[model samples]
Every structure is written in C-alpha cells, then in structure tokens.
Target: MTHVPSAAPFDPQTATIAIVTFNRSNLLTRLLTSIGEMDPKPGRIVIIDNASTDDTAEVVESFRDAVAPADIVYRRMETNTGGSGGFSEGMRVAYELGSEWIWLMDDDVEVLPDGLAKMGKWAPRFKSIQGRRYDYDGSAFYWQYRVAEPLGIPIPFAPAEFDASGYKAMNSGCFEGMFIHRDIVQQIGLPDPRFFIYWDDQMYGWLASRKTSSVIVDEFVLRRTREIKQWDMGIRHMNASSNAYRYYIMRNRAYIKKYYRELGVYRPVPFALGTTLTFGKELIRLVFVERTVRGTSNLFRGLRDGRKIARDASWQPMPPLEAATTTGR
Candidate 1:
C-alpha cells in the first residue's frame, strides 16, 4: 500500500472517526451521540459492524442523516473478526477515504466533548518530541487496561507511577479512546489480524512507540461504560482467561522479543522465564482458584496452539512500511 501524505492542513473537519461495534447497539448509539456533540466535530464518521446479530446496523442507520458536521459511513463485515479485525477494517477504510487522523473507539466508550480537542492539542506535541527511532515523548500517556472492581471488591494492582520515559518497554495503552495520526497508520500498517480479539492495542502501541513518541494526556479521560465483573469459569472460561488472552499474550510477547532482538536489544533469559511463569500462574488461577472447567480447557488449548506457533521459525515481525508520516500537524 502506498503511503498517502497529509492531504491538507490539520483541521478537525479532515479528521475521520472510526468506531467498531459488535452487538452493543444501545451503547453504540450513545457513543455516536457523544461524538455528534463535539465542538469541532470530526469530518467523517465510519462505523464498522462486526456481523452483530443485534440491531447495530439499524441504530447506525437511524443516525445517518442526523449526525451533524460528520458524514456517517457504515460498513458491515460478513463475519465477526473481534475487536482487532473490526478496528483494523475501520481504520483502513478511514485512511483510504482520506482522513487526516483516525479516532479509534470501542462500541461502549463515550467520548466527552473535549476528548477529541485535547487529543488534537497533545498529539502533535507528543509526536514532535523525538526520542529514539521508535521512541515518542509526550504528556498524557494512556494506562494499561484496568477492570473496575465491584463496590466491595478491591482493585488488585496499585496505580504504578507511569514512567513516560519507559514507554518503549512498557508498551501500555488502550484503543478505547486512542487518537492516531493517519501518517502513523500508513507507516505502521493495520493492527495484527492474527490478534483477532485481544492485545491489539498493546501491539499497536508497541509498534507506535518504536516509530514515534507518544504519552497519555492526563486531563483527557474517556469513560468506560461496561464494568468488569468477576470472572466466571462456567461458560467456556478459557475464552477470556486462556484461549484468546493466553494465546495473544504469549504469541505477541514472543513477537516483541524477536523484534527487539533484531534491533540488537538483548532480552534477558529471566524475563522470558518470568513471562512464562506469569502465564502459568494465570492458568493455575483459572483451574484451581476459579475452578472453571471451560476456562481450564481453553487455557490448555491455547497453550497447545500457542506453543506450536512460538516454535515455528517462519514467524516474522511486521514491517512498519504502512505507517503514516504525518504526526498530528
């Protein structure tokens, strides 16, 4: 794919917002409404329906003529490609349609009025302060994924002091409210389709850090609509704990290790061992603690499958050719 230069100067009207939705029609409608209320509204809006069996298409169609300042375009995928695939398709469409920036959001995330504006302000600054070849420096970096504990439940991990300088190694961020420059997308290409469901954001952020600088804006906060409930092991526990999560965690981590290795960054053997132990702990938690039969089975299957992929010598890191050149300016 050819890298498209920034068509015109940076204007909110030229920024395209791409939202990927599954079966959450109601939540998607609210998110769309929030986008419509932005002060300097996005130029275009593209909604990719990931073969949702719900009323997602109808909800989008209802707002087609109603959303102001932003022209709405909807693409319905024939099959569910999970979050990674859906967003990849949405972003690709946005780039092809000549968007200067692509605002990627989850179906349930509600964007505050100032959300885009804040990103618009900080994105350029973040990209301008250079570090290494792939290192970006900026304020307001995003937090890794966090689940909301119920009223009585205690949060597990304490909020760690985010070392902005350590972003290259941390590779932590979420796509729920990520604002990405079109040029970066062109150069980085799309999110890994093999990821299919989970860890796509981490992988993309990892790639982004390598190409340019980025930081999470402190004042810019996007509210997550859905709360993380307690882990239930009964209904195919592995889907969440083992199958999807484990496979990507292992496969992608290996991919990252190999990538850095090629860059002449020597990874410690202990780090690899620690990562394996971490996965094993998660597996034990699902089987012994959570005691979910389905989760155990999924973990077993994921390990079996992931191990096979990890051993394959044909695995290769994705090139950064499709990355877009324009930062935010």
Candidate 2:
C-alpha cells in the first residue's frame, strides 16, 4: 500500500480520484468538471472508459489542458466489462500509479468540492470505531446505516459490540462516492468480475469489513442522477432490462455463499434457507407479475442457471458484454 500524504503538506502528494464511466459522456463531463473545482485538489485523476462509442473520449480530452493540479489519465477498453470490470480496471490503475488513497465515484454522481475534505476528516475516526453486531431476536431487523429524518438523513454510528447470535451484517451499500485506503484493496482482492453489475460493491465491502471496519461517512454528500432507460440484453442487441443483471445477482450470490462457507464464516442451513426464500420471491414475481416476455424468460433462465451452478458446484466465467456507444436516446 502506498503512503498517502496528509491533507495539508508542504510538498503534497495528492490522493487519486478514480471514476468508471460508460457511454454517459455528459454526466462524465459534469463529474470531471466538479472534481476540477476541489479545493485541495487530487494529485491524480483516472477515468476508465468501458468501450463507450459516444463522444466520451473527446469529452475527456477537452479537460486535458485544464489548469487543475491533478494529472488526468484517460483509458479506453476494447470491450465493455460492465461496472465491475470498469471499477476494477480504474482502481488497479490508481493503485499502480502510487496513489495513497482512491476515491471511487460513479460517473452519474455529482460530488461537491468539499466532499473529499469531509471524507478525509471522518476517515481516521471511522477506522478506529468498533462495529455493531446483533443477534437474531426472532424479529425482523431493519438495519440501516443512514437514518432518515424530517430534516434530512443522519448517519448511524456502529456500536462497539452487540449481540452476535443468528445475525449477519446488513447491506454494505453502494461503492459510489466511497473513499478507500489503498491497503484495503491490497488486503482484499479486487471486485469479483463474476458479478458483472449488481452486488459487486456489496461483496467487496463485506470482504473489506473482515480486514478492517468501514463506516458510511455522513459528511461526504453525493447526488446520484436517476435516468430511466433500458439496456441491451447482449445477444439480441435490442434495448431491454438487462438479462445479464438477473444472471449476475443469481449466480454471484451462490459464489459469495460458497466463498464464505469455505472461510468458516457462514453456516449453511440458515444461508440456504434465506437464499431459497429470496430466489423464490424472484421466481414468483417472474411467473405472476412480470409483464415483459423477455424479462420473464431471463428471470427463469437466471434461476435455473443459478440452481444448476449451486448443485454442481461449478460456476462459469462471465463473458464481456458489447459496449453501447449511445447514451440512452
């Protein structure tokens, strides 16, 4: 792990901001422009383009001559590897470039200038605080990291210790706008490429929690732009809700279950029961609720494939998806 320089330095070594972008050229440009305004500027900035066919490359190039303190490196992939692949590539590049800390931001998120500064302030404290554990009380648990209020959402602090019988960690949430120590990645490997999209961040964060505790920094605020659109289902080259998403969620959960089992951190009976219930819900939705023919077919296929992998103890490697050049029209 590289040593990160203090926020205040005489000859400052800057933190690196690594962003993963696809065909969202406009959003990417906005994020980059916002990053350029950060007060204590990052030392380096890296953008991994997931084979975007749009004007993404040109948009990035426009910022090359900007007077920002950070050195910009834009990389283009030959194929689109989805969010998981793009994030992995970007983080690897940032680490190899000797960044002390890596700030992972989604292309569609708009981060304010003070966001990193606030994160840096809270980071050391977050690492030092103890985690909250819970036991199953035979009641449903609604564990959430951020608490919503009439005024706004307040970040929840983890207690030093709590009951630990029949309980598991709640969702670790999304990785976007996350500030990570480089060593955490070194200790735990990169995001699982098997998870092409959904739950990749959750899996990575869960593994990291085993190495060192993580906290949701309340001060660092990021706004995510929600744009409704459909995606190509790979083979057909037709726009639809991605079948690949369903496949990943189903398959990778099994992979995660097995991985934890091997580590002696997971118990099979409860996990199996929980997983079955979860997948069964999806099955019910596919059969009774889902109106789209393609979506229903994909859901059934995902469930069948997922069960097959679990039964045979053999998981196939994911194939890269073709990159779409058009930012949803």
Candidate 3:
C-alpha cells in the first residue's frame, strides 16, 4: 500500500520542474523560455545534465540570469549518464528539495506555457498525473499504451485512441511530459537507472500505478519537439533505423522483465511470446522491408544478452538520493 494525502490541498508553488538534458542547449533554452512564459510559473527548476560536451552549462547559467525569481539549479554529471540516470538523479534532487510535485520532461519535449497551470488544476485529485503530448507537426503523439486485455505487457495504442477524454488508468508512462508527486517518489523510490535508456520511464510508471492511483488528464497537453522517425507498420509504428537506439531498446528487456516480476505480473511464456511476436515483426521489417542489416545484429545480441541481465540477482535498484552535486558549467 502507498501513502495518499487524502485531504491535502495541491499547491502549485510546491512544484519543481525536473528537466534532464544532454547536448541540446538550444532545446533546453527553448524549454526554459516556455517556463518563463508560464502564467503560474514553476517555483523551482532542477536540471540534470548528462555530461554533454556542448555549451549546456552556459545555457543553464544564461537561463538562470534570464528567468529571475525562479531558482534554477543545474548539475552536470561526471559522465554521460543516459536518460535513466539523469531522471533518477533529477527526481531524487527534486524530492529532497521539498517539491511536493515534480514535473518531469526530457530536453526535447517543450512544455506549453499553460501546461503547468493546467495540470495543477487536478493535482489534488490523483497521486500521479500524466500530461498529454503532441508531435512537431501538431499531430497527436501517442506515447500512451494499451495494456493487453488481461493487463500484462503494454502494447502501442491505436492512433484513434489519442482523442479519448476522461481520465483512465495507464499501464505505462513517458517522462516526455509526466507530472509526478513526491509521495510516489518516496514510496516507489527513483527509476532504475540500470535501464540506462529506453523503457525505464514506463517501468517506473508501472511501479507507481501498482501502488496508487495514476491517470492521464486528457485536457493537459505538452508538445514534443523531437522529430518522429518511426516506420509505419500498419498495426504499429516500429523503429525506423537507428543503431544507437536499437542497442538500448533490446538490451533493456532485463529491466522490463524485472519490472513485471516485481509487479507480480510476469507471465514467462506469454511474455516471451508477446515479446517475440513484437520483435519478430521488427526483425522481419529490418531485414526485408527496410533492408537494413545494420542494427539487426544488435537486436539478436540484445535479446541474447537481456536474458543474462534479467537473471542477475545481485543487480540492485538505484541508490537513495544523497547530497547536492557540483555546478557543472
């Protein structure tokens, strides 16, 4: 069971915007600008830099000077920690800094000027609230997933389902534009940084959903500035062609398996079959349709290596939040 502050009022001032950024200084600047334009502005902003060689530090310092009144703390990591590590550190810092609510987003996703105010309206209703997102072209970005009828592994949702209203239970989540309360952070701890990249956010979402009420407010919208490179697979949008992304996507099955087992929903044969079917389709597309053998080997290697990663009992979850980090600029 999770702790729910039943009658507590949600204070917008208690919100801290936790942003994880890499090399995209321009995108980060744009996001900070959006924050500057907020009607009810964010009280605090914690940026976790993933060790970018670019002028990420300069951008943060510039924003600190530009966005007066909003206290912005930027921490540049000693190494290039992936999204998982950056988010883990950012969430930890936000909670420790006494933020009742943590508004999480990647560097690429730009929050609408009104997005924070909109989500704040329903902050008192749910333990965890997920905001909606749009692609660059104003098209509906469907990061939400449809859990299998029996509620096991979540699959990509239908495009038509994007317009559905009324808050509903979500099986997964994207940090793309998620609003997380501190209670979930305290109870669930940080996202497993071991995931190192993809699917970690959804795993955290699954963990939070199991413990408390989590919902997506259809009215609140956050637009993603990242370009969509997905290949249309008739039934779903599969990865187009990225050697770098494929490695992490396939390698992180170990974390997903652990995620399911922790939730007591691990159906070995069924899960394996479901995964095989899903990946098999992509494998076929990679070899035949796209005719790209570049990342196919990674897919095979990831599947093979993930089995080992899942079986490692010694591996543990992310450590508890600690002291403040160095101001890296």
The true-versus-predicted C-alpha distance at residue 298 of model 3, in Å, is 0.4
Report residue 283 deviation for candidate 3 (angstroms): 2.7
Query: Which residue pairs in candidate 3 collide?
Result: none
Off by over 4 Å in 1: 1-10, 128-142, 145-170, 230-268, 280-294, 321-329
Q: Which ranges of candidate 2 are over 4 A from the true structure? A: 1-13, 127-173, 228-242, 280-294, 307-329
Q: For each candidate, C-alpha RMSD in Å?
A: 8.8, 11.5, 4.0
List per-prediction Cα lDDT, in the order shown. Answer: 0.61, 0.58, 0.74
Model 2, 168-265: lDDT tens digits are: 23325455755666666676656666566866776666555666656543243555553423232322111123567656656656666655654566
Tens-digit per-residue lDDT, 140-195, candidate 1: 22243232211111123435344553322223345676667766776777776666
Best by lDDT: 3
Between candidates 1 and 3, the one scoring higher on TM-score is 3
Clashes of each: 24, 0, 0
Question: Could you tell me every candidate's TM-score relative to the true structure?
Answer: 0.74, 0.71, 0.87
Which parts of model 3 are misplaced by more than 4 Å? 1-6, 149-152, 158-165, 232-241, 284-291, 318-329
Candidate 2, position 295, lDDT: 55
